[model samples]
Structure formats: structure tokens, C-alpha cells
Target chain A: MTVNIISISQITSYLRELLENDVMLSDIWVLGEVSNLKRASSGHYYFTLKDDAAALDVAMWRTYTSRLTHNLQNGDAVLAHGRVSIYEPSGRLQFYVDMLQPAGVGLLHARFEELKQRLAAEGLFDESRKRPLPPLPHRIGIATSAQAAALRDILTVLARRYPLVEVVLSPCLVQGERAPDSISAALYRLYAQDVDLIILARGGGSIEDLWCFNEEIVARTVFASPVPVITGVGHETDTTIVDYVADVRAATPSAAAEQAVPDMAVLAEAVTVLRQQLDEAMSAQLWMHQNALHSATATLQRQNPALWLARSRQQVDDLVQRATRQVRYLTERRQLQLDGLRQQLITLSPYATLHRGYAVVQRTSDGGVVTAPAQVQRGERLRLTLRAGELAAVAAPPAPIEEQHTDD
Target chain B: MTETSTETYETLYTRLQETVAQLEVGNLPLAEALALYEQGVQLAAACQRLLDSAELRVQQLQSDQPDDQ
Candidate 1:
């Protein structure tokens, strides 16, 4: 063995290092009754945690003291969490507490944190795995204590929001040691009935009372449910593993029921809106057809035979008027030509030539004109003609040829 | 006794929605559109009837009862 000389500071420092480095002592929780509790002007807390066997000195820094949920008093059982270390100045073991809670609750909270981390690592609480609740659930299965006020609240909400849904309650123990198994069994029972949705609910209670909702068995059952689940366990502040695994988390049991189904009034209003849309759509379609028919009728009127006949009649009347005017002009031209021809005929008449001539002689017996004295016999008859009269005469002839020639 | 029908409110509502959508397209013939309008009116009435006549029914299972399915 080697002997070494050291001062008090050195020994205290060594002891502090040894105690601080010890894994089990560095971070731990100890349950004991609080004794000699004191608050200093620095906002630090000094107390002694004692049991039947022994006592330990505890100190909480000002930063941690503000986090204390409960005021410390003498003889109150508490679970204090901190590191055990040797105080260098006094070379004494002291618990430097950072957290203090009621004994059982503190222990339960530790287990809860551990389980939450383990389950979260397994992806049990993944948001992607969360199922969407049905917009209109036909049947909603409720898993809760039959005698619990949560059940009444859920029922009242369901009745008010959506009376169309059929509610099936699978009653179970919501507290105590057997509650975890009871809750899981209730979930299976609801599943067997083929519920469209499920509501897991419990009224507000102590952490111990609500411990079953935090149980692994209940969480697994909720995660495995065929339908989507809505969880409303404990109060708004009390969250559990089931809430993490459920599809929807509500603040209270009534809220869970509300989440399970849609309101009838809203559905009715939607139906009315849809009906109105249908009416408007149908009216628009009809109007379009009516307009099309109107245009078609107008087009048909333009092509009507009656209108074509009227146009043709007008054309015929115009032609008749032109034909009458042309006939009148031709008649007038023909009359004028006839009158001029008659006047020319009058100028060329033979009677006019006779009017200008002298008298002429003719033999009456033969109706021959005589020009010489020998043309008639000794007792021949002769006739004289003028322009307007005729005369008859007798002639004697006994002249010699020489004498007749001399007369010519 | 409750008047129970084979058609659910969801089914009727879905049909009503489809009918409205088809009508909104505005391409169907007059007779066809008229028939669809009549069908949509009936579907809407059926939905409203279901909603109006609804009553919440609550039942509890015996904890110790065996599965009787």
C-alpha cells in the first residue's frame, strides 16, 4: 500500500468525483417522507427525506424549485429524482433533486415515459398510421365503464349530433388492476360486432385511475381495431398511450362521440343545397333546349312556302302590268301604219288619172276605139266618152283611099 | 317500429351528388335530363326522410356474455 498526503479540499474533491461518476447514484429516484422542509431566500429548497430505516439530505436548485407542483411539508411521502453526489465543502453525501412528485405518481410517470419512448420507437404512434374517421358512421361502438359519467356524456352527444347512428356500448372496468385487460376485451367485443367506428373513453381521474388507458395492452388493441377510433380518456390535460394510437383524439368523452358521426342538420342542409343545384341545372338545360327550338322555328319560318308563294305572286303581277303596257304600244303603232297606207292608196288610184284625160271615141258594135274615118262602115254606129259622160253617133263612109290619107 | 329501408342515407346522398354532377355537365338530352332530375328529387327526399325519422338507439353488452354470433 502507498500512503499519500492530501488536504481537506483534495479529499472532498476526490469523494465528489467518485460519487458523481457512479452510474446508479448519479441519476436516481428515491421515495421517502419529507422532513425538515425549508425554503431559503435564494429560492432554493432544503429538506430531509426519511424513512423508517434512515434519512437523506436533499437540495433543489432555484431553477428546479419553480417546477415543483406541490408545496413541500413535513411528513409528506414523496419521490425525489436527482443525482447523489458528495458536497465538496462538507464532504457529505447529498441528493441534488431536480424533480419531486407524489411517490406512486412519480413512479408511474417514469414507467409512462419509458413505455411511451419504447412504443414511439416501434412506430406505434406514427401519424401515417392514424386512420381517418368516417364522415358518416352508421354504427359507433363505445368502450367505457357502464357506470361512468363518460358514457352518459358520450351518449348525450351522439344523440344530439347524429341520431342516425346505432350506438353499442361494450362496458368494462376503467380503473384498478384489471382495467387494462377489461378495456382490451371491450375493444374486441365491439370489433366482433363490426362497428364502423369506436370511441374509447373514460372520465377524469387520478393518474392511477387512468393508468389502464396508458397500458400496453389497451394501446395495442386500439391500434389493431378494424375501424377508426376516437379516444377521450381522462381530462384534456391527461394524455395516454391509447390517445396516441387512436385515429382521433378528443378533449372529452362528448367530443369523441361528436367526432364519431356527422350532424344531421348539416347533412340535411347539404341535401337541400344539392337539390337546389339540381333544380338550377335542369332549368338551365331546359332553357338551352327552348332557345335552340326557338331559333329552329325562326329558321323554318324563313323557308316557309307561303312566303315563297307571296314573292312569286308579286313577280307575276309585275309581269302582267308590263305585258299590258307592251300590247297597248303595239296596237297604237299598227293603227298609225294602217292610216298612212290608206292615204298612199288614195294617191295611186286610177280614177284620178281618168279625171285629167280628154274625150275618146269607140265603135259601139265592138266596143273599139276609132281613130280614123275609115274605121266605121257606111252605116256603123260610134260612141264618144269623156271623163264623166258618154255619147253615141252614126257615121257614113264613102271616102277614097287618097282623100283619106290627105285628111290624116 | 322504425321505418327501415335497404338504402342508407350515405348511398342516397352519394346518388344525389352524382345526379347533380351529371346535370351540371349540361350535355344530356332533354328527356334524359328530366328523368335524372326526377330521380335526384326522389333521392333527396329519401335522404331527408331518413334524417327526419332517425332516433339514437343505445345498447350495452353483458361483460361476461359469451360470443353468441
Candidate 2:
């Protein structure tokens, strides 16, 4: 009845309002196979939702497209939830997707598994290829977005745990289409550095946000890194392909930092233990040597040469005293005997007889005994001997004898 | 064992260990034993000094970059 010359815009605007006002169409769920999928450079997603029976047009703006967990492709069965709306200008009816999910099993998950199996079959995730991390790494290379909170967390933990480690930040994008190449480049850059280890890290995110780490190129690059790579790409629940290919896997960025370096407190404690061991070992050794020295000193004192010499000197002195006493006694005894003999001789001497008033005459010529007075010559000289003096007389020996007798 | 002050912590610790082992044998002559003991003491002291004086050091690498894949 409104065929009363109504314009096409008015009719389309009226239809758009009618379609938007329908509560069932305003918010609804549609099950279909995706077709004609296209991503505009402006980040919008355009596609057709179709089944064996019917078809529908779909459009997801950039904000909603960015939230998609899986990449849409032709003939992917999905459950799309959004509103039906009409464009007045083009007079087109379309479904604006707010949320999209795989119809039964997620196709992206299947692709992830597919890629994982293929890579695993190719030996990219071989355990034998994994390398041991350096015990004390001096240089640690980090591949992460500089603006990410994950980087801040890693830096904070590293500074707290091991400030001695040199940190080389190889910045890259952590998500979106360019993330794979950016991450691969960052890993390659780190591999060229003189680093002992590498840490590829990212904060927790949705599956799509974490998709870069699951990329085959990122995984292969991490697998081929010269230095051992440690991956901390998401929360504990998120596992990426790079995580499997890396030498080590950590649950969080802070955990990666923990694995990359040693704690200073622990090392300090080790040094302290070593010092204690040294002290105990040295003290025990010194005590052992001291005990040995004491025993040696005791043995030396037992055979002391000074003590032996002193004992020998005392023995020599005692022998000298005995010999001196024996010599003195013998000399005294002989002197006494000699003195007695001299007394006897003195008592029997002729001089003693003269003292007792006896006299004898002798020949002056030969001093023969004057027993025979007639043998004396008148001119011969004779001598009289006394204890104190000697006298000489000639020819008058008789008178001299008389005078000697009188004097005696 | 190095007696120079520039000895590293690892080197100093290793020498201190060796000195301790030598002293533990205890069969050297008196003068030699005393000298070794003195050296061991110094080594232990030097190890302590090395640990004490060492401060954590950090640096950044430069000059190498790879093309984006």
C-alpha cells in the first residue's frame, strides 16, 4: 500500500529498523560453514556463512576480528554469535559476528595439533637436540617486546636474583601477523650475540594472542638457536610450539628469569660453606702437625746430647778425684818410712857417736879410718866434719882429736 | 696458589683447597710444614677477601643483528 512513490532509501531504512528491532535476530546463534573469507587491510573480516541449504553474509569489524582465536578459512564449520542488521545504502542484509567458535572441534586446535605432529615427525622437537644450560651464564639474551609487562617482570626478577648477569634485550612484537617473523628475527639476533643462554618470553594471553609462539618459523628458529633457549610464553596453562622446541620451558616470565641465573644469596651461602670447610680443614691439619711436632720433640728430649755430655763430664771428675787421693796416700806412706830410716841412721851415725864423747883418728893422705894411728903421716892434712861446720888440721891430729872430744 | 691480589674467586678457592690437602698430609719437615701452613692460612684469607670484594657486574651486548625472517 506504501507504493505511493516511496524512495528506495526509505524502504531500505525501514527494513533495517525492522530487522534491528527483531529480538530474535538482534542477538542469535547461526551454525554454518565459512566461505569466501577475506581480511581487509583495515583489519576487518568479511566472509560468507553457508550450509547445504542456505547462505548468509557476515562482517566482523577490526575490534572483533582481533578477538578471534582461530583464522577463518573456506568451508570451516563454525558457530557464529552476533546480530542481523541491514545496510540502508546497499540494501544488504548481513550478520555482524561478535563471537565465533568452531562448530564441534576447534579447527585452529586441529591445525595446532597438525603442525605439532608434523614438526615432531620432522624432529624439530627432538629431546636429543636440547642442550644443557650454562651453569653460570655471564650473558643472557632475552627475546621479548620491550613494552611488554613480561619484560618488566623478567628484568625485576633477574636484578633481584642475579645482578651479575648481562642482559641483552632483543626486542620484537609478541603478537599479531608480523609476530612470527619479528620473534624469529629476535631469536636469530640473540643467537649471534655472545650469550650463554636465551630467554624467549611473553605475558599471558589468549590463544590467538599467543599464536606467534606457536608459529612454525618461531619454533624452528628457537630449535636452531646456538645458545640454549628458554621459553616463557604464557601462563602455566598455555603451551606453545616454541616451548617444546626450546631447551627449557618455564611457566612465566619471572620463572624464566629464575632459570636464567643463579640467586646471589645462594651463591653467597655456597661461598660461606666453602670458607667453613677451609677453616675446618686447615685447623685439623694444623692440629695434626702440632701433634707430630710434640711427639718429635719428646723423642729428641729423650736422647738429648747435652744431658749425655754433662753426665760424662761428671764421671771424668769423679775418676780424677780417686786417682789424686790414691797418689797422695802412697807418697805420704813412703815419706814416713824414709823419715824413720833417716832417724835410725842418725842414731847410729859416727857424728852422733862424737856427740856422745867418742872420737876416731884418720890418715890425712887418703882419709882412711884412723883405727891405726901409726899409719898417719905428720904432714898429711885431715878434716873433721861436724853437723854445722868443717875444720882442717895438719900433723897435730892427736891434740886436735883430744880437743874435738873435749868440745863434744 | 696465586698470591697476587687479582686472583679470581674460583682460582683462589681451588688453591685454598689444594693447600688444605697438602697440609693435611702432615709428613713434611718442620720448616716446610710451617711454611705450608702459613701459606694455607693466607690462601684462606685471600679467598675470603675475594668473595668479600667481588661485586656483581652487568653489561649489554652490541653490534650483531639478524634480518627479520
Among residues 3 or more apart in sequence or in different chains, the pairs in candidate 1 whose N, CA or C atoms overlap within 3 Å are: none
- Residue-wise C-alpha lDDT for candidate 1, range A273-326, written one tens digit per residue: 999999999999999999999999999999999999999999999999999999
Candidate 1: misplaced stretches above 4 Å? A1-27, A33-41, A47-57, A71-75, A91-93, A308-408, B1-5, B65-69
lDDT of 2 by residue, A82-153 (tens): 899986667889999987888764545656777898999999888998898886676789888877899889
TM-score of every prediction relative to native: 0.71, 0.53
DockQ of 2: 0.13
The 10 consecutive residues of candidate 1 chain B with the worst lDDT sum are B60-69
TM (chain A) per model:
0.67, 0.53
Task: Judging by DockQ against the true structure, name the best candidate.
Answer: 1
Q: What is every candidate's alpha-carbon RMSD to the true fold?
A: 12.4, 24.3
Docking class of 2: incorrect
Tell me how large the interface RMSD of candidate 2 is: 4.4
- Residue A142: error of model 1 in Å? 0.7
